[model samples]
Target: MKLDRTDRDIVAALQGGLPLVAAPYAQVAAELGMDEAALIDRLKAMKARGIIRRIAAAPNHYRLGMVANGMTVWDVDDAQVAELGALVGALPFVTHCYERPRALPDWPYNLFAMVHGSNRDEVEEKRARIADLLGGACRAHDILYSTRILKKTGLRLRRKG
Candidate 1:
C-alpha cells in the first residue's frame, strides 16, 4: 500500500503505541492535526486493505501473576496438522498457536502452541485440554516452560529490502 505523508505520520505515531485514554483515536488525531473521523476512516481503510493486520493489547502477564508461559509442541499427522492447529489456536488458554517445520528424527514436533497460567499446574490443565482436542491425531506433545521472563516491546517498522 502507498502510504501518503499523513498515513506515514499516522503509522509513525501509532508505532510508539496507542494512547491509554478513553478517546485514543481523537487524542491521536488532535496531535496529528487531523480530524478524528478522518483518522478513524483512514485506519479502517488501512485494515481493510491489509496494511494493518490487527490492533491488540500486549500485557505483561508476569506482572499480573500469570508467570508460567509454556511453548507446547506436538507431532501430528501432516494431513490433519493444519486443521488441528486451527482448532488448538482457537482454544482460549492457547495464547498463540502455529505450525512449524520439523527437522529429521531429532525434532518430531510440527505444531506449536503457547499457553500461559499462574502456575505450572494451571498450564498443565490447559495442555490436557489441548491433548483431548487433538485426540489420536496428536502423536506426541510436550510443554516447554519459560524459566525467565523477557522484556516486551512494541512493533518496529523497517525499510523494505
Candidate 2:
C-alpha cells in the first residue's frame, strides 16, 4: 500500500524497534510529535495493509547465557518435512526450524533447524534428541556452530524517498 506522511513517520520510528519502557508507543508518539492513539491507529492500518508483518522482541541469546548455537540441517523425505519441521520448531532448544530449498551443488542441506543452549554439550544433546525424533525420515544432517555474531536488529520499514 502507498504510505502517507504519517505512515512513513511511523515506519521510520519502528525501524529502530520499540523502546523498552512502560509505554513504548507513547514514547514513540512523543518523539514523533504524534499522540499514542494516532500511532496505534496507523500501526493497525499498516498491519492490516500488510506493510507491517509483526512486532516482536529479538532477544539476545548469548547474553542470556545461551552461548552455544548450531544451525542443524537435515535432508528429510519431502513428504514428511513439513510435519517434522513443526515438531522440531516446538522443541524449546530448537529456536528455529524451517524448510528450505535444497542447497546448490556445493551445498546439500534441505531442512534447517536452529538449536541453542548454555554450552556445546547441551546443544549437542538437543541435536541428538531431534535426530531421534526424526528417525529414518532424516537422511543426513549436520550442525554448523556459530563462531561470531555480526549484527542483529529489527526490520527497517521506511526507504529514503
Candidate 3:
C-alpha cells in the first residue's frame, strides 16, 4: 500500500516512539500537529495493513535493579511442550517465554524463558519452581547468564524524497 503524505508523516513522527506522559498519544499528536482522532485512525489503518506491529516499552532492567537474569532453556517433551510452555510463561518470575525450534541431537532445548531475580539464588529458586511445574514433561534444562549488558536499538529507515 502506498502511503500518502499524512501516513508518511505519522510514521516519521512516531518512529522515535510516543512521548512518556499520562496522555502519550495526545501529546504525540499535538507535537506532530495531527488531530488525535486522525492519528488514531492512521495508526489503526497502518496496523490493519501490517505496516506496523504493536508498540511496547523496553524497560531498563539494570536500572530497576533486576540485575540477576538468566536465559533458561528447557528440553520439554514434544507431546506436552506447548502446554508446559504456557504454564512456564504464566509464572511470576518469567518475564518472557516462548518455544524455539530444537537444534536436534546436539542442542535439544525447545522452550526458552527469560527468568529474572535480584540475585542468583532467587533465579535458582524460580528455576526450581519451573522444574516442579514441568514435572515429567521437562527432560532437562539449563540457565545461561549474560556476560555483559545487552544493547537494544530500534529499526532505522533511510528514505529520499
Residue 138 of model 1: what lDDT?
88
- Give lDDT for model 1: 0.88
Rank by TM-score, descending? Answer: 3, 1, 2
TM-score, cand. 3? 0.86
Candidate 2 stretches with Cα past 4 Å from truth are: 157-161
Query: What TM-score fits each model?
Result: 0.86, 0.85, 0.86
Off by over 4 Å in 3: 1-5, 159-161
Candidate 1 lDDT tens digits, 1-161: 68877777878779878999999999999999999999999989888987887777777889889989999999999999999999999998888899999896999999999999999999999999999999999899888999886756555665333
Mind giving the per-residue lDDT tens digits that candidate 3 earns over 1-161? 78787777777777777787898888878987878887899899998998887667766677788888899999999999999999899998798999999997999999999988778898889989998999988888999986567665454544437
The lDDT leader among the candidates is: 1
Ranking by lDDT: 1, 2, 3
lDDT (Cα atoms) of all candidates against the true structure? 0.88, 0.87, 0.84
In candidate 2, what are the lDDT values of residues 63-154, reduced to their tens digit? 99999989999888899999988998998777678898986675677789988889999988988999999999988889999987766786
Question: How far is 23's C-alpha from truth in model 2 (Å)?
Answer: 2.3
Weakest 10 consecutive residues, lDDT, candidate 3? 151-160
